[model samples]
Target: MSPISILTFVASLLFADLVNADRVLGAYIFQRHGDRSAKAWPPTKLTSLGYSQEYRTGSFFHDRYISDNSSYQIDGISTDIVNLAQVTASAPQDDVIDNSGEGFLQGLYPPVGSIATETLRNGSTIQSPLNGYQLIPMSDVRSGSGSEDNTWLQSASSCSKAKFSSNNYFNSKSYHDLLSTTRGLYQSLEPLVNQTFSPSELSYKNAYTIWDLLHVALIHNSTASFPSSVTLTDTVMQELFVLGNEHEFNLAYNISDPIRAVAGMNLAGEVLTALNETITSGGKSKLNIQFGAYASFLSYFGLSGLSSANANFTGIPGYASSMAWELVTNDEGTGMPPHVGH
Candidate 1:
């Protein structure tokens, strides 16, 4: 897993760098959106809990990358009012992802209050709204804008080769076998979605969709009774989770066809490019963050050989899960002679 690097479970990576490098120059972060209403059902939104989760996750990173207490803090980065040029952020136009990005940034650059006040020529001091709230701008990578393709966050419809590979999974023998074996399992859960999805959608083909709806409802609508009287046992939920994981993982990566993980490949390139900026700018550009989904995580894990290093890496990432690439070196001053780390 050594071609390039970004950190998910960061302890190992950070520890390795601490042993090899003296100063952290910069970093590139790619994080999943916070919990939301299930994507399996549309009109999805970022829940309040989702917002909190993202904020906490961002604050955690702030402690790790920008706070004075952090030993690995990115050199030359701001801890108060943001130097916007030193950092860059982006997310898709999607509501869930975009809002999650805002929440995370709020944590990363918290209200500086009087610390950010500016004195006018008349000697009157003014503070930004919400107690010197940092107005950090994030680029909205609009869908179908062609930017997504380059950034490795593109929708399925945009990548013909990847799309073709994903569709091929549906026609495979393994798919057919699973559909047959899971017939009764899926049929039993029909009562839960019969009112919303038509009868045709109650089959194994919609395993992930059906499971997603139920899973999200359990988390967000726990006070309410389920639509059906059947016992929604934990065993059944786990089974459903496994099935959905299998389905989505297949869609994201297939070792035989590199095209399947195009998004992940592009993500590696994007991360490399971001880190390169820090090197070229002599550490002036210190941090870069992007909000995204787990499909890209799965794709990247498989493509970058992380799955081989740790089997758990193949699984879909959870809400707010982040991977980072730190640009670090032993050199002093502002000269950023970057060193790569796994």
Candidate 2:
């Protein structure tokens, strides 16, 4: 080959290598919440024991990340995405266990006549403590009663309309039918959920769990006295504990193409920006960003509702504000070039 040609070839090779170097401009992450007890409802709320379970779940995340290891760290200039908005139309109402009606109460006490006999049988009681205990006789307890006639009127009233309708609104069949419809809706969206991430992805199991947690937290922040800083701290803590393990480390290491990695990061940043915008906007809906389910971008970010919301958002089409960069050949290498024309 001629000297000039040889020189040109070497120069092109070097340029290609330079172009291939990864430059991460942004990133977007959508994650599901960590594991949680079933949704608060007749069937799902934590039993008296469930309260402990909830605390333990919270403690696990807290200790794993917040106290034990400060693991969530990233390189380069980028943006973080989080949804601070309240997306749930309603809060989780009193669980059904708390509202089993008069029958539940009746079961706790002995039969109306039996209670008096038991109180007398115990004997040692100085005077059977009746001040706090308001037990109605079994005969007096209302039977064949509708919901309103139930013993725990106050408890029943605390339940939300959604819960009441599902449980007490109609008989068990009506409740089951409503439940079926809800399940059907969820099943229809199953494809989108499955597509959001791959099984091999880091924290895949925790992704959906985290999403649900965030949803719960968002609701708490909206209706209760939860501090935003506490919620944010909880979020960061979970990310560090859950996503900063060896699995993700290896996955990050496996990417041989620097430009693709950088592109992925940039895409992640865009998502973060959108999420931040959604939170700051004070709207009821969450920011939904959908990449193919296999992408795992949301899991990477440690937020959840984005993908779920993406699947359901009626106003915006899929992947709003998404920027596509072209894999182009430059003097450097296979690099993503900023596309000028759409």
Model 1 misplacement above 4 A? 1-18, 142-157, 332-342
Q: Rate the local accuracy (lDDT) of all candidates.
A: 0.75, 0.27
129-236: candidate 1 lDDT, tens digit per residue: 898888789896432222222212334336788878877888989889999998888888777767666766776677766777788888977634665468888888
List all candidate RMSDs to the true structure. 4.8, 26.6
Alpha-carbon deviation at 339 in model 1, angstroms = 10
In model 2, the runs with Cα more than 4 Å from the true position are 1-45, 73-91, 94-274, 277-342
State the displacement of the C-alpha of residue 335, model 2, in Å, after optimal TM-score superposition: 28
Scored by TM-score, the top model is 1
TM-score, per-candidate, Cα-based: 0.88, 0.18
For all candidates, the clash counts are 2, 32
